[model samples]
Target chain A: MAVDGRDEMRPEDARIAALYRHATGEMPPERLDSAIRKHARAPKDAVKPQKHTLWRPAWRLPFVAAALAVVCASVVTLLVERDGGRLTVPPETPPPDGGETPPFSVQREPPPFSQSMTDRATVEPRSGRAEDAPTLTRKRAEPPREAEVRKSIPESKARIGERSAAPPDGRVLGAEPSHSSDAPASRGNKTSGGNAPLAYSQPPAPATSTSPDRVTAPPAPRAEDDSLSKALPAPSAEASPAAKPAPAANPRPAPQPESAPAPEAKPAPEAKALARKRLESTPSEPRVPARVSALIAELENEPPARWVERMLALRREDRRQDAEALLAEFKRRFPGERLPASLQQNDE
Target chain B: MLAYGEGDVAAFDELYRRHKGPLYRFLLRQCRDGAIAEELFQDIWTNVIRARRNYAVAARFTTYLYHLAHNRLIDHYRRRAPAALVSYDDEEASTSIEEIAGSAHERPEAAYEARQKAARLLELLQALPTAQREAFVLQHEAGMSIEDIAVVTGVTRETAKSRLRYAMAKLREGMQGWL
Candidate 1:
């Protein structure tokens, strides 16, 4: 017969039979019972993670903190760099003193001579005769008072000079030679009671040589007259015919002999030496020979004052010729080296 | 005493007292080696202790206990060396008491035959394919229904029923004349 009957028997029949037989039988060997006990005891010392809690992965907390830190740092750095770039734009509106635009307005004006001639013409229409001029006539009549006034002028004039130097229009005061017209009135006032004629006269010589003749000559003549009023009358027996104009007013000229000597004691001599030193210490362009550099270095410490005076004299005679001579001398010394782009051109 | 959910040693000992023998016999029948059965028995009880926090009172205690035992036996089969599966050939010559029934009542002959039959039954058990045997033991010997067998084997009731039916048919056919 087919075994369907056995197959269809209840699921528990086999287990119940096995259990009944097992219950009635002798107990299993003691060794078997003890083995089960030993198995349970073995795992007591094992240190597994607690069953309900997930294992604490050792690297996880530090890893998360480090990742967050890196991301935050990157974001902060990006924001700072971005803000810096936007903040760096050149200021659109200039400061209170203004900027570079005013100088171009200056360069567009008429020639320097024309500007000085205009200033002199404006002041001259109000001027009295040469002998009756307010500053000069008063100085000739009252010498001691003139000297006191002249001394006081420097302090007040220094303040005015500072203001003129900082023009409201933002144009630099000395940008053009035409402004030299403004200097004569101030210098003439200084020379009116002049104890040191050379100090007052030396400035005019440089001014005359540097500025255009039309702009500087008229102002210089005024300064010379101011210097004459300080002279004492000399005794007639010893006076030369050449000194007559000054000796008539200066009945004793010996006390003022020091005025003529002041011009000979020049301070620009030191300034020239310092300028040369600056040039020597500033390294020449790389192509110049070492021998030429050493010569230049020596020249820097002790500039030849005679050469600068000769050069200025030559410039008065002919500016282009003086400039050519200086360039030729420089070329002869360093024929293979090119001049710096700035130095190749004159300061003018 | 610590509660059942606390994983306390005492709670676990009580759990062991309630189910250890049945689970041990179940593994012995499933593995057929005293050593392997003993090893599997300990492993099953250890898994019970380990999973103590996960246990609840929703089902019979035996169902939960035998489910753990069945799972461990399946795991042992998977872990066994390839040569161990092949060693079933050595067990082919052994047979069950159900195999020699006519003279089984003859005193010493019956005693000897009974012992041989028990040995043969174990061999037949080992000879069955792992899935069929697992289904058969969990259902018939563990006293689990098809649904309980499915839960233990992680299979559907249909699959457990099919496996049990096949196991029973094979055993019935093989022991036809002897039984």
Candidate 2:
């Protein structure tokens, strides 16, 4: 494997040795300088050296090239194979010896929300889930008063009308046996009007595992209310004959089947008034939750929480005007709530 | 060379002044043609200038310089087109021979004798293989060591030694009483 060039070398055997010694003997130190200068200054286009000076240290180049190639290949192979032919997951720390490794990190799946986001709106009903609802106000009292609001609302209205048409209690406040004439309108509300928006909002509530109280939060209540008001007539309109029961308790329930259409007559104006009236009437603390304020602060510092994404999705679906109207109303109602940067940027 | 390697242009000029004559003489002896010798000489010096920036203390300055020269000559022959070596006509041959014979610039008798001897030596040298001639010239005329010669000739020291041996034996046989 190794070539030993000097082993059997003999000075006399090589006349070259003698010639070289003789030739060099005649050369003075000054001559070497002159020759080197003349050679170095020679124009490149001129003929090459009569014979090249460099012996090449012939293996040096190949050895260096091979070493470089090995280093590069090893680096590439390490990148490819170390992760079993998948993309490399760079080591979290660089080697202690201080050589370069890639500066990259692999993305991991998002953390499960229920486990991590404990304070989220997971407790509310599917229809008016608080998380699905954008926060339009920031009252310190909303969280504590949620149950009270649910209790105060007409239970019949709260029944999320689709799943079970049967009354929670057999008491239908007022139902005339001959009242079958107007049943179609009530069914229509459930099928096509306010209840339609209600049903649509409900899907996100369950999917997002958020509460309806989130939607009803007074801060951005108008958009939430608008969506709700749009969804309301659907269920109300869809309520079938089965949903219409005979009078059990009082006459008010009887009128609801009739007055439900009243909501349809001027829903747009009424929903806005209802939201304004609710904001004015409710106690300051109960109107907006402290948690919501904290979330607002967090969003102001960072980006908006999840509902902003839904809003964006809506915007992307050619609902830009709707989204803009809702966003402006939300910002107005929740004066201090921070909008996400993208929304803020768009607004500016 | 050391001074030149350190960037002294004066040193470079001095080295040029010092080595040019000897190198020219060596080239003249090896090539037997003034034009070829001058050309090879120029090449050797030009190479020295090009390599000065990278120079280290390698062997003696003399060895390095001529080592470059020795290899340049070899490369020149290798690179020359085959047809370029066409036989010279009588006039050109005689003129070249006379020039070579006149190269000894000593006293008349000594010059004549040295010319005859050099002529005879050149004839003997031409009879030897290229490798042998190169080895002999580098060793005896250039005064390079077997090791340095190996470096210049791109051969093993053993090979250089073999060529020198073969060359010497032939010269001894061909010019028995000449030296």
Candidate 3:
């Protein structure tokens, strides 16, 4: 311990060391020692804390939680059913596949994404030139693009304006030159005159399963449609004789797909106004998309700054066209206001 | 320590009883504050109790205990004075003339009577830079040999020896009359 001779305190250093020890030598307070004594004694018996082994098994708890959540959800759901619908879970909006399946058919097949989505293979026209129908069927497979839908809108509006705008007696596009008989069948649907929202027109089933067999009380006309319709008067039923039959036969138990072609079942702007009219006229909700009334109404009177914010939000919702429409509307609404450079870049 | 680890409560009490005085003095001198010293004193023992299960028979018990005390002292200084930890291992700090004069003015001129030499020695001890004072206290109060001091303080033996030498020289100068 003294190899470096630091241990050899000179007799003077020795005296100084002794002096320091003499003056300052004092033990810690008795209470502190007792506290330490208590701490020391406890750990001997506290060996039970080796619950470290519990963690090895604890890792499985995530799966346990998932299983418990699943079991609890299912048990609770069953109990709700058993209790005659008292303790029911929050209602999830059912996917509006083309036709409504009975409630018991949940998982009766892999969700109707199976029926309407992939196997829309069956919609090749039942009556038109067979070859032309496949192209429309293939086009419907992908959801309609914004540009194409926008492109279809001008044509639809022009056709509606051209055909319907003139007649003093309120006779709009009734007899198409191709389906002259088609006009009356469409006008007959009571709801045809109701300007339904674009969302009301659901997807198409294949021609066969565009199941007229399951037409639920023909969709009710939305209030917005009522407001919108007042802008354009209902075509006098006396004017088109075809507009007469659909409303008269509510459960027109004719299961074979009616006068509206299956291609109208695709939500293309292909036969926009007529199809919307026909969808309203049809007993089942046909995939007839109406005017963009909802967006204009929603974006109405919001703060000008918030317009771009809503546009950005629409873009985030993956409705890029809605975002663009809102942007154009914003530019029209606040013609002089400069949008954020980034939003303008995204718009470009 | 092995006996203590084996749950011999008597062994720990006997160990604490033997070392508590020097360790308390070591902490008191390292920190000039009494409450901080007491707090550090309790902390070192608490650590000792906590580490008892893993207490090995490698180093001398005083060395181990003082090693804990030394670390506790450095931690206390580190928390209080951010630069203290790095400055701690250096050679003795240079005391400024103003600081020396200020502390000197604080000394009781009348109390420098012969019997009060020990009190003056303590005041002088506190006036020394922390590293030199710690080395001197480790040598004197703990009675640690230079090698054991080096091990406890985590310095080389020569460094420890030089610090002790410096400390002894200063105390000798301050206590020249007593000598």
Candidate 4:
């Protein structure tokens, strides 16, 4: 018969155990024990790892220093790879030169979205952020509206704090920062310079950034033309393209007339003198494009991709503190957006 | 075991001296064949020696030793094919278990009874199914608690307890008139 297997302690368990032990008092013979003991005693059979002096206190400092050096070098290499080498980096511009560029600007050029957006959307201008995030919304609503663009012109110019300060190098106001003929920057600039690059060919033209031709830096009187003409730099005729067809350096001639009278006439003397001094200070450079104020507005409007590029530039320079701060701001401004491929891996 | 893992031969000798008898008797009762028991006994010790360097103090050394014994026994049963050892979850494994016979199984019951009381007990032990006999031997011989028995045998604690309860009940009933 099969027993019902109930799992409970039995009162007779102790008795059964005692009786079983008494009945079966069997043990392994001495021979088996001797054999096992002999096996255990086999020479060098055990696996013991040998201790090394690397962990000693004396070697600690050198080890730590080497580790730090490796880490720093890796970080530098990663940043360089991310931002690109010397050719891609924009010139170092002071905060005033930043001209309301976003809180972070590894770039000196106006980003694609336009300096209008970059200038108006200042990171430090907390008052403007609520307004700035919605600019894209506003642009989306009335992207090509002349009336809308005109309406935004005054407000944008008003927010432009350092639009007057320009890159110290005589590079054209809106031209590439490192535009040496041999460098890749020159090649990129030639292709990417757009309609404005020809206008900015001579850095001397922006020297007249003193004018309303400076592209609405002074809050121009002609609202309609200045609205659309704001995208053009007033004095960028390196090809003398402005002299013949440009009707004198400023491409959009009508707005320039009013801007020239109202804004340029006022600072024309002081600015020209300052532009001349800067021009003399840096001979080999593009020449004082101090009037890059228009370009300043342009640079401020750069895209997230541009900002990331700049952050990489900062990192390549081993400027980690600045890079970290810029990256943090970039993340804050563009939350939930997937970073570019270069930054995405590092982001994760 | 830890000392032996650190290359102390004497520690291994001490462990062998302390555990050999209980382990040997366990195999002897489970197989009920001296030669096979001796073979398994030596193999288990050889395994212990080979594994000494990798041994960790994760559980009682005795439990580790017994776990090795249980696995060896399972392997032995597997080698002697056609006598498939079903899981303890299946209670009706007696038919196949009878095929796991030792030379002792052929001995006459009359001869067993006529001998000493020890022989009578051994005879009753051999009469039970393989798993039941194993449960009884592990409990009474190694003095393992139900929990240790479950871990060593790779079964649940409740199943180990039930096997012990059922084995003891059956053993007691077998010796009812004689004891």
Top lDDT prediction, candidate number: 3
Off by over 4 Å in 1: A1-348, B7-11, B83-111
lDDT, candidate 2, A34-98, per-residue tens: 45555555554344453343435465788889999999989877753432211111112222224
Candidate 2 is graded, for docking, as incorrect
Candidate 1 lDDT by residue in tens digits, A31-101: 75566555544453355555323455455778889999999999987875443332222222221122211
* lDDT (10s digit) by residue, model 4, range A1-348: 112235345545554565677777677777877887877787652323222344465678888899999999999777644432221222222223223322111111222111222222211122112222333334334323233234433443433333324422221323212121111122322212121222233234332231222232221223332322333232222312322332222222111222222221222233323432332333233332343322222223333444556667766877666555566545543332244455556556
Kindly list the per-residue Cα lDDT of model 3 for residues A1-348, writing each as its tens digit: 122462563676666656665677567788887887787788655555556567655887888999999999999777644432211111122223333221210001011111121112111121122222333223334343223333334333343344344533332233322122221244222111111111123254321132121121111123333332343232122225423443332211111111111233222233222322322333222222232334544443233444556776777888877677667655643333356666778967
Give DockQ per model, in order.
Answer: 0.07, 0.14, 0.40, 0.28
Chain B TM-score by candidate, in order shown: 0.70, 0.72, 0.86, 0.83
- For candidate 4, give the lDDT of residue B129: 67
Q: What is the Å distance of residue B144 in model 1 from its true position? A: 1.3
Ranking by DockQ: 3, 4, 2, 1
The candidates score, on chain A by TM-score, as follows 0.18, 0.16, 0.22, 0.20
lDDT of each: 0.41, 0.43, 0.51, 0.49
Native contacts, share recovered per candidate: 0.05, 0.18, 0.72, 0.47
Q: Could you tell me every candidate's TM-score relative to the true structure?
A: 0.34, 0.31, 0.47, 0.38
